[model samples]
Target: MSDANKKAIRTAIQTGIGVAAALPMIVAASGVPAALPWVAGALAVAGGVARVMALPVVQALLPSWLRTDSSASRR
Candidate 1:
């Protein structure tokens, strides 16, 4: 697969995993009901954001918050 496609897929997977992990905390902190669908909804939102950010133009224009060194090219 092309690198762009790979990147997008990777981003989506990571976002889903992250949202899943945070599902409990987000619900608890927000005092929202701990219904199962809330977790699914959060993951959907995160996935959509990741998809938007996966666009080449958006990726190019946005500085990655997790970057340790901004000087070099990212993997």
Candidate 2:
């Protein structure tokens, strides 16, 4: 509904898609021993969350010169 909520949902869906794509490779490369895939999946989800959460912090830390805005207000 709101922009913040929409952004969060978009981030989560993108992360889920990434995990879905990577999980099979992780399982195949590591050779699943029943619990290993589950463990890897958990770790992947955690990492994805951390990454998404860090985005705003990273943007804040970046120099203004390095940031870009396409809004008319920026012109």
Query: Best candidate per TM-score, number?
Result: 1
Find the 10 residues in a row with the least total lDDT in model 2: 66-75
lDDT of 1 by residue, 1-75 (tens): 999999999899877757765655777798776566866677566667666656665555556774334442253
Clashing pairs in 2: none
Each prediction's RMSD to truth? 10.0, 10.6
Off by over 4 Å in 1: 35-75
Q: Candidate 1, 74: how far from true, in Å?
A: 28
Candidate 1: the clashing residue pairs are: none
Query: What TM-score does model 1 achieve against the real structure?
Result: 0.46
Model 2 misplaced stretches (Cα beyond 4 Å): 33-75
Q: Compute the lDDT of residue 20 as modeled in candidate 1.
A: 60
- The lDDT, on a scale of 0 to 1, for candidate 2 is 0.62
lDDT of 2 by residue, 1-75 (tens): 899999999899777756655665666687665366667667677567656534655545545564333232243
In candidate 1, residue 53 scores what lDDT?
A: 55
TM-score of every prediction relative to native? 0.46, 0.41
